[model samples]
Structures are given as C-alpha cells and as structure tokens.
Target: MNLAVTAAAAAGAPLLSGDKGTTSEAAVGETLVSRLGDAMLGLGSRLPDMRPETLGWELSHALTDFHTCQYTSLAVRLPRLLQAGHALTSSSDSPEPALLLAQSYTLATRMLIKLDEQQLGWMAADRARQLATAANDPLAVAEAARNLAVLGRKAHWHDAALSVALDAADDPALRTAGRRGAAQRGLLIQCAAYTAARNGDRDGMRDLTAEAASIADALGGTTLLRDHGGGFGPVTVQLHLISAENSVGDPAAALAAARALSPKALPSQERRSRYYTDVATALAHRGRRDECVRALLTAEQAAPEETHARPAVKSLISGLLVSGRTTSELRGLAARSGLLT
Candidate 1:
C-alpha cells in the first residue's frame, strides 16, 4: 500500500525474459500496458542471487498491499516482481524464483478479480498454473488451483470452481497432515464454500465451512500460515461464512454471521474491511439504510481505498443513494462516496 516506495532495488523483483509492452492481454489494455512498462522495466534482479527469503518478504508485502486495496500501487509494482522472477528463471534453472513467480501470479489473479477484470484475472491464473506446474511443487499447484477456482467462481462458472477446489483438496499433497497440507486444505475448503454459495447450494456452503473449521480447530484456532492469502484460521472461517451467505442472497444469514463474530478476530485489515462491506451489502438488501451506511462507513475507516473501490460497495452505495434513502448520515456518506453527485 506504500505508493511512496516503488524503487526496484528496495523490493526484490523478477526479470521476465520477454521485452516489455509486447502484449495487450490485460483487460484495461492501455492502462495495463502503461503500468506494466513502468512496473516491469523498473524491476530487475534487485538481489544478485534473488534468494527465496527476499522474494518471500517482498511478495508477502506486495500481497498485503494488494489485499489492503492498493490497486494502483500494485498495478505499478507487481509486474516488476513478476518479470524479475522470470528473469531469474531464465538465467538459472532454480525452482525457488519460479515458485515465487507463481505465487505472484496468484496474487495478481485475485487482485484483477477484485478490480472486476475477470478476463485478465483468468490470464493471470493461467500463468500461475503454468509456473506452478513447471515448478512441480504441490503447494504451488494447490495455490494455482485456488486462484483458478476463484477466477472461475467470479466468472460464474460455479460447477468448474467446485471441481477445481475438490480436486485440489483431494490432491495427495494436500491430504497429508502437516503445515502445507493444512494451509492448502483450509484454502480449498473456503474455495468450495464460496463456489457453493454462488451456486446457491446452502448445504454445500455449510458443509465446506464445517470442513474448514475443523482444520482451523485442529490448528488451534488462528494460525497465520503464509499460504493462499492468509485466510486459514478460525476467524477466516467465519468471514467465509459471511461471504458465502451474502453471495447466495441470504442477507439475514450474512448479517447474523457478521454479528456473531468479532472483527477483531479477523487476521488482516483487508479481511476486517471486507467483513464490514459485506455487512453493509446485507443491510442494504434487508432495507436497513442507516445501518448499511454505518457499516460502509466503518468499512471505509478500516480501508478507505478498498471500501471506495470495491464493486459491491460502490454498487450498494449507488443503489441506496439512487433510491432516495436520505438519512443525514447516509447522505453524508453518499457525498463522500460521490454517490450524491
């Protein structure tokens, strides 16, 4: 989220073997081209050896930044790291950098989906899959599958998403009882939960959540294992429930779930913000205008950029405002959100 610090030397970036600006595959073609030029050309092999630790830290920070709704900054930063990873891979046959690159693509896939660029999201997920496969790493493949499942869900391919999640969850790599298996298992469960929600299969949603909750319980409540965007704990299971209920048009259940758990239990600012946003959406659906506005205001306080730019948030604000829900508090928020204009 730090737009002020984009210097390549400060962050470990990957080197893509291909020249810059060669393709316009991203949804916002020109915008992405411009961003990628700055993003990719600037990020070289900042570390001569490009150690996995440095890449991991840089990637983790980048992932956090993306999660916190720093899209513009990510647009200007991720390409550098991705291309830098490619450069490392081409220069040497090391799997570490490639694995990191796959992770980067996974983050990119998620971010683009949030940005509502599912076409580009699919491309990013595909790249992640290719890299993960080449690396021949089980965790990486699971991560790739997770990304693909999300992209499929967003694209309204609910059945495909469910298939991907189930396949990844059943993978021998993720079946074992260990740190990696636990993380991947938790991630796959959430993936299946959301996809089931999209399909409006209430039982499927609950079943998947129960499965994930068991993993969280076995892991002793909340453990932040740096895999699949850090949502594998008890708190995350609850958040997933809120999201699932919301997706399936169960506003009452979504609100109930949101109210039952403390946002304090959520691991990151991003998740906290999203929880409030979902609450706002459910409130809006339930015709509780004032509460909806209040929840959105709380979400904005958690992460202003995220709340402002999120499609669901924007849509909810616009809908309430357009419908003439004119409480003073709601109008104030509407003005700030540019909904009144």
Candidate 2:
C-alpha cells in the first residue's frame, strides 16, 4: 500500500514542462509511468501481508488521493501524455507500466461515481476495463468490475451492480486464502444491502448488512491491499451501520455511531460530505432542525460543487425549506453560504 501510495504521489508529479511532443518530455513521462507500474506490482505482492484495518485505511486514503489526482490530471495532464505516448511508442506489446495507469484510471472512476460524476466515471470505467483485460489479470478484472458496480449503484442500476459483484464473487482466482475469500462475499452482500435499501426492503437490508458485517469482522486483521473490491473496512463497515440504523428509524443510534466514526478525520471532501449528510438527516429526523441545518451547511461546505446539487441533499433542504420554524433561517443561511444561486 505504501508503495502504491508512493507511486501515486510520484506519478502525479508534473511532467517536464515544454512542448508536449518533445522527445525528452515523452521519455520522461514513460519512465515515470513505468516506475508507477512497478510500484503497483510491488504493492500487489505485499497485500497478502496487510491487516484488514491497515488495508482499509490505506485503500481509503490511497483511492481518495488517486481520484483527486486523476481529476486534476485528466483535466490537465492526460491528453498531452496520451498523444505523446502514441507518437513515441509503436509496439503493440502491453507494458507493465500500462497496468498502473489502468488501475489508477479504475480507481478514479470509482471515486467519480462516489462523487456523482456520472459521465466521466463511465468513460474512465470503460478505459479501465479495456486496460485490465489487456493485462490479463483476474485481480485487475475484479477491480474494474467493482468500479463498474460503484457506477451502477450511483446510477441506480442495482441489477447491473448486483450482477457484476456476484460474478466477481464467483471468480475462483479471487478466493485465495491470502486474499481473504470472505471479503468477496462481503462485497456481494453490500451490493445486496444497497439494492435492498433502495427498494425499502427492511428485512433484506437487515439480513444482508448483518452478513456483511460478520464477514468484515471475520477478516478483521487483514489489509485492503489484497482484495481491493472486498467490502470490509472499519470506516466502510461503520458507514454501512450508520445507514442501516437510519433506515430502521433509529436516529439516536445512527447519530451516535456517525459521531463515533470521527467524520472530521476524513481527508476527502466527498467522504466528509457523506458523513455530514447522514448526520444532518438523523438530526432532522429527531426534529433538531437547527442542528440539521448546520450539519447540512457543513456538508455543503465540504463539497460545495456537488453537495448543493445532490438529490438527497436537495430533498432534505426542500423539507427544511417548508418547515415554518426553520425556513427563514435556512433561506438566510443559503444566501450567506452562496448555495442559493
């Protein structure tokens, strides 16, 4: 994981500044991308040694950083490099460095889906799948499929996500001992839980979430590096618990669990926004309108570009806007917060 993180950090460094077509710049970028690939391979080999807790934190932070860097790179750096790579390389043989680039793109797609960046996520996912397939690696394939599931969940394509996760779960190569086979089961359960939650299937959600939590606990000492798609980690499991508690109308417990998770420590704005949104929803359910509004404000502040436009946030805000006790205050806050454009 540290190697992957280091590679990610290094790969994200600015390319040598000059003409994009220059031989010198193209060589430099190729070298950097190759190094990044070597680092990812090294990290992959060490994943079996990682504990689940450490893996969770590593994956969470690494994926988060990976996404952020991709967003920046795609918007600025990728196109130039792609053109340069095409001009500089004529061989059809897939390079080891290409795998790292593909994985990074896959991770970026996952993050975009999490942040509701639908179109971009789809594009990135497609490229990742092609690259992973070319690499002929089962782990990479499973990872790409998992990213697709993230997109499916975000787009409300529950059936699609379920199908993909189930397929990944059935892959024999991904069920190795060091990979923690149960973790794959947990991913399937999470997909089921999300589908159940969307359909208001209380019993289904409860049963599936419980099963997922159990698997997560069973793999408690593992790191996320080995099975990136496995759906167990402290922060992620806690997040599932919070969602379940809220869905079951247990606001007090939901709030308590959310608070206990220390949302403030999350480095990604996307994650922070999600935590705050849950807190706001729970507070609102308890009729703590002021507190709810404040939490909502924090969420919006954390990721202003997307939070204000999110369906759930909009729905919650609409509810608060009609509440006589808080409508005026909310309007004032919206204006001051620059959220009411």
Candidate 3:
C-alpha cells in the first residue's frame, strides 16, 4: 500500500489540482476519499483466495500505509471541503450539492479514523457532523458519530468512545439494513471492549467482548462496522482477537493468530516485508533471538531501503541491543544486512 501511494502520486495530482474553488475542492476531496475506499474494498474482496497469513500481512501493511499518508491529505483537503459545505448550507441554494458534499466529508472522516491521528480525526468527524446536519441526513449523522467513536477508541478517550458508540447503536437510521446494523453494533462493542482492556478493566473488557461475540454470531459472523459501507467478514474477528491477545501480553498467542492469518507466500513485496518484520517481533518476544534475526534478515532482504527504517523494526533492534544477550550477533547481522551501514 505504501508503494501504491507512491504510484498514486502522479494520478492524484490532477485530482488535487482540479479544485478551483471551495465547492470544487470539497467535491474533489469527496471523490478522492470515495475512490480510495473503493480501492480498499476491492483489495479486500480478493482476500479469500490468498492464504490467511498473507491476507493478514497485507491488511497490516495497508493500514500502516494509511497511517503514513492520511494526515497530509486531510490537512490539505479537509478545510476546503468544510468551507465549501458551510457556504452552501448558509445560502438558500439547492441542497443537492450540499448533501453530496456532506457525504464526501463523511467519507473523509471515515478515512481519517483509520489513520490513528486523534485530533485531526476528531476535526474531520466534526465536519462530518455539520455536513450531515445541514443535509438533513440522519443516517449520515449516525455514521459520523460512529466514526467519532472509532477515533475516540484510537485516541484512548474511553468515555467519549462509549458514548458515541451507544449513540450510533441507537440511531434509528441504522435500521435501514437490519443485518448491517447488528453487525455494526457488534463491531462497536468490540471497540469498546478493546478500550476497556487498554484501561486495564479486565472484567469490562470480557463482558463487552462476550456481548459482541454473541451479536456477531447472531449477525452470521460479520463483524466489521457497516457505517464504513464495506462487507464485514471473519478477518474483523481475527484482528480483534489479535488485539485482545496482545493486550494480555500473550505474544505467543498473538503470533499464532497472526500466523494463521498470514499468507504462506506473500503476493506483494510490501506484504512480504511486513510479514517478516512481524515474525521478527513475535520471535523476539518469544526469546528466539536467532530466529528473530533470521526474520529481520528476510524483511531487510525483501525491502532493503524501506523496511529497515520502519519504527517497529527499529524498536526491535533497540530492544535486542538492550537485552545484552544478543547485541554482538544482532549488530553483526545488522551490518551484513546493511541496516547499520
């Protein structure tokens, strides 16, 4: 996905530059977010054929790529979209474009939630709220609130996250699609559980997760939030399991789950690198220093220029250096891999 971002740069220029005024800018921003969302969904649709481990690796890397790029794009595009929507709202003009603009802002808000940027994500959510209100679309408003809930989870704003989730779960517009609404509620419950776990409320986490799992079962095992407007599947549950395991300091369990989801042979270079890097971390946590080094070597070989600079990879190196048991060997390996050179 990071490489895709680089490839998308040239194509994105025309989309970025064609915005002549506030309204045009908002329109374009909406198109861009929608397009990106569609692209992600398309990628996900192809996942069934790939190995679970490989699919997991790709998802992880794509999310990392999203984290890297969403901030810059939001900063450049969001204000213009908001201003344009506001202008249309204040005027007694036709609300069609305003409604469309609101939907666009909502899409952007969803994208921002995925990026792990708290403040900017909240700002985008606020814009989405205002646009939805102006457009008189209760469904859009509910969806925006749900997105805020997700952002709050990422930011560790527990009370705010729970409130937003509850509000979304109760929104009447959510009933438009019965199974989807239930699935969305289930995912929100999972998010709340995750937040509870982070706060060290074990009972709270367990209770919430249990309820979410029950709802997911009732919803036929779809766990992804419907507000995101994509098909939710088992991967959602697997990711939640991974998070739960990690929160409990069960690196072995986390690794087992991750390994079960990753592909045997990564379909993309980016995915191959990420998979090996994760394998390194899991091995390191398990005290398998030599195996960890081997995984790191593979990651470095896969994407020599970019993978070595990854924060996770760097952190792993630092941890190993401080451990005192494998510093010399790791240093030698790093030199050979050109990571230290």
Best by TM-score: 1
- Model 2 per-residue lDDT tens digits across residues 4-34: 0111111123433332322221123233343
TM-score of each candidate structure, all chains considered together: 0.82, 0.63, 0.56
**In candidate 3, how many Å is residue 19 off?**
12
| Full-model lDDT for every candidate | 0.71, 0.56, 0.54
lDDT by residue for model 3 over 1-341, one digit each (tens)? 01001101111223343224222221333334443444323321211133324323433333343333332343334434444444444554755555555555555565544333355557667767776777676655766776777787677787888878776766766566577666666666777777776666767777877787677666774434313433344445555655565565566876886777653433345445656666666677678877888887777666553343333455566566566466666786544423354
Task: Identify the leading candidate in terms of lDDT.
Answer: 1
Clashing residue pairs in all predictions, respectively, total 9, 7, 7
Model 3 lDDT, residue 253, Cα: 73
Question: Per-residue CA lDDT of candidate 1, range 1-341, in tens?
Answer: 11112111111123233334232112222344344444434533453445667777778778877666554455545766676676677776778877888888887776666656676677777888888888887877887788889888877899989999889899887676476678678888888998999899999899989998888888886655455555577788888899899888888999899888898877677788888988877887787877878998898888776665555565676677666537777666555544454
Clashing pairs in 1: 14-81, 14-83, 14-84, 14-85, 15-83, 15-84, 15-85, 15-87, 16-83
List candidate 3 segments past 4 Å from native.
1-103, 106-116, 136-139, 221-230, 259-284, 288-341
Which pairs clash inside model 3?
A: 52-261, 52-262, 53-261, 53-262, 53-263, 54-262, 54-263
| Residue 128 miss distance in model 1 (angstroms) | 0.9
At residue 289, what lDDT does model 1 achieve? 72
Stronger candidate by lDDT (1 vs 3): 1
